[model samples]
Target: MVCMKDPTVQTICEIYEKLSKLDNLSPSKNVDTLFTQLVNTCIPPYPIDVTKLCTQIQIIRTKLIRLCGHAEGLLEKHYSTILGSFDTPLDHLYIFPYYSNYLKLARLEFDLLTQHCQNPTRFAFIGSGPLPLTSIVLASNHLTSATFHNYDIDGSANSMATKLVQSDTDLSNRMVFHTNDIMNVPGSVLKDYDVVFLAALVGMEIEEKMNVVEHLAENMAPGAILMLRSAHGARAFLYPVVEPRDLRGFEVLSVYHPTDEVINSVVIARKCPIPTVSSIDHQGFVTQMTCSKCAEIQVFNHQIEELAMEEHIC
Candidate 1:
């Protein structure tokens, strides 16, 4: 106002305000253009760290692209269902950015795990999506692993992960990729790992998630660490895609708020030793096992026969 607010300064300030409000944009055809403009204007000055700034912008752009892709894929895949018929653009946007939080939690978990690793340890990653890659990067940076096995149902995901890890010489020696259904992973096939990572796996349906957790619990060796990152809240307020169950045997190690809307919780549960039937008293309880171990009775039941066979053969 004093000097017409200096036109360039006014323009920059206007763009900054628009970018700040981009999160509030309603569903409209013009929203995309609004985001594009925001992205354009967020570019830093010429002397700034251009590579870092560009990477940040690309991350935001990638999030948007991934959201659109997921929405389109869901529509195509579930065309017969009511959800498939509904346009869920906002849902995609909401969940896509949550991965940024997931990445933050993953780094924390990786640091915690690395501090505890005394020997060469294998880390198995289930649902080897972007979050797992974040963990992989942390692991590589810290030189924490004996090796890494990344498993995903999507062949393309496996391929991408393999390519990414292989491109890094330090990570290349430590990472292997497996393209297969997580449900089909044999308990024996999973037993050697020291740590099992379940990132983004809980975002699946309840039954499927339980199945995956059950499988991980069964396959992991006693004393092995199972690290899980998932969206959590009471049922009503929680994300509806994946149902949250009681954490059960897992111990909540840390809960981090990486963003305003998203809370990333890291749970580290030691794979409790499955007590043999002979080890139980007449009441079918192991007197020495803790209350947490008692709660794991059902998980033990589902796994005992298979684990017994595995131990015998070994």
Candidate 2:
């Protein structure tokens, strides 16, 4: 339905061509002004490659952080400006049905995962922003309820999120919000959570993000799951792109797409046997599990490449 002749399509293609040519993907370095310009331009929402678009926006945001510094909460300021207030939040209104697609997609992914009825009933959501949208959606709709541990670095946004949670009696009873830097939290805090959601734009640098992933391995209770939120296809940069290649210290179980209009990818990973640094593979050791009774060990050669199964329909 979209024609190549459209100026927006032409501009998008041009941006892709430019990004493909650039050798340096460093955020510390200044990016071509055109890519940033292309992102901010009033482009139509029709049939766009959201993965590429979000990646480009992510580049622009990282550059902004590098140039402006996060000391004054520059990144949060920018994100909040774009998302606006959650009071009578547009996402909650869902005047446009697709507006809540992100939340629906998240819930669907959770369902796709195998849950033992006895699995821990606690979860932590990082970078929950002004309204813990996904957490809210899941907690309110699911047949099974779990405790939610939410965190945000921005003080004002954290307060707003807390207020939002309090406004709902069910959520106030079910959710807890913490105000702290996502990067600085002590690993001890990870002890109580069964699952942790890593937002794509957690306002941490690449190194900081990597540190969080590593710390989770050392701190999360045994059998805990880490649900990594990332932007994949279409406007991936929108969620600050993360691939299996960009991670360490956890065993990725699967890569899945939500059965909705939103095309972001959700990667589910779990803690593997802790190994010496020299023995670790791309992410972590190959999956290995042992039966408690017979002590029979099973080796799972499931790497990200071979992990995808028919667990969930996209």
Candidate 3:
């Protein structure tokens, strides 16, 4: 637990209090000011035992996410209205102050994805909020030929996001929006995608984040690439962290923690093609074998017979 006497903790609490009451209206200068301060306050070299303060940190994280969501919504609405009056909406995308950030982040993800997938044709972006800037940036600047499927649970956010690109013919033809939870997406549909990106705020809690990762691992096509946003060091206070060990059905490829202004770390992994289970029987005998060339599996109990019932496992 974080001690109240800690100066950093006190400053963080004060900043959170101020941010909680900050105006969420468009042009949220005050909110941005406080958030900048919070970012500076959350710089690395945190006190020892930061893991013990997960609960407290999560409380602050939830508030921060809410604040960001509101600010994003306002900004999206403001831009959408302006774009509606223009002939080419995408031409003005750079007007957003943080547009370059999304551009850099998208380029980083693109470079990482290209390292493993030679020709990725389909991409599913989970938790794409009202702006869907990452998807827009990737579609507009990089991976121009790929089809993007943007998913968000909020109908209003989806409605707003659609407006941002509806007038742009290139994006409208390539970008698709769905208002549904990722868990509700069927495996049949998921199998069509070559890459899937999980947004940082999709699962704010560690358990929830792991559950989503496991779901993707279980449903995504074998050999499909899964990219997720994670945080390292003090950034964990703002976003949930995903350890490589937490990836059960996929083989982690790389974990990149940016020391620069980029907030979220990037994790890229590939779904294992085969399922091979190795478990010790009740009699203390160890059974281990690969189902096939690409199959890898892990049996929790002594259920050896169940392996034959399932065809292709991830």
Candidate 4:
């Protein structure tokens, strides 16, 4: 049967054209059958382009749908087993859309942050969940030097991330997976990151959140960007939370919530040098001073009259 020309058909045809070039053809038969079924199922009164519809169906069937199925299967088989051991059901603990939104916002933020950097940069993702958005972003483009370090508290999540990274050659060399707590991410291991991502960790206690932030602030080099997203308001209250206080060395450039249900905020902080303090001696009392101008605290000694005099003059 000849399919009539239509936008749907046109889209299908475009997708088919692209699929024809893929070297992997093992799934072609299944894809073809799925495509045909989708085209046939479309409500019909108007003329439809079967070929074009089939093409578009193939693209969706082969790429997005298939990947989604794979991801779901992986979660059920791997993630479910691990989650079942815990007291809470997997669904209760995880807010899927929250993570999904995080991925979307992270990509947009990363693009904005790295617009000026040269091709093939490195990034570190703290509290990296089952799906590492950073790996996806790096895989989206052909970056020769792009590398990702995904750190998470869950062994299962890290394993899943490793599998995802290794499955794609483009991501294999560029991604590294670590099963580590965000709060305990070693200082030596954290440095020179173009982008550092923190997502969904808002459910964690406020002290833990601040600890993670402090670690990032202290370890990250100058000009590094921190991308974060979390549930705010009542949702945030689910965990023993701490409001973000002023981070001594970092400046908050912007704060925003992308959606009403999700209190997702992004704080892009630039690192400033930590001022050093010289010891002061005054009347056998000692005090250390960070800086007189910044009001940074320091120790001072009463014995050093000269240093005290200098401190007073400043």
Candidate 2, 77-112: lDDT as tens digits: 433344444553333434322346655565655664
Candidate number that wins on TM-score, 1 or 4: 1
After TM-score superposition, the amount by which residue 85's alpha carbon in candidate 4 deviates from its true location, in angstroms, is 21
Q: Which ten residues in a row have the lowest lDDT in candidate 3?
A: 293-302
Give TM per candidate: 0.53, 0.61, 0.81, 0.51
Flag regions of model 2 displaced more than 4 Å: 1-10, 13-98, 115-118, 203-205, 258-260, 275-314
Give all candidate RMSDs, comma-separated: 17.1, 10.6, 10.3, 21.3
The lDDT of each candidate is 0.48, 0.56, 0.75, 0.49
Superposed model 1: Cα runs more than 4 Å off: 1-103, 114-120, 130-132, 233-262, 276-314
Q: Candidate 3 vs candidate 4: which has greater lDDT?
A: 3
lDDT, residue 179, model 4: 83
Rank all candidate structures by their TM-score, best first, as comma-separated numbers: 3, 2, 1, 4
Candidate No. with top lDDT: 3
In model 3, how large is the Cα lDDT of residue 171? Answer: 92
Write down the lDDT that model 4 would get: 0.49
Cα misplacement distance, residue 212 of candidate 2 (Å):
2.3
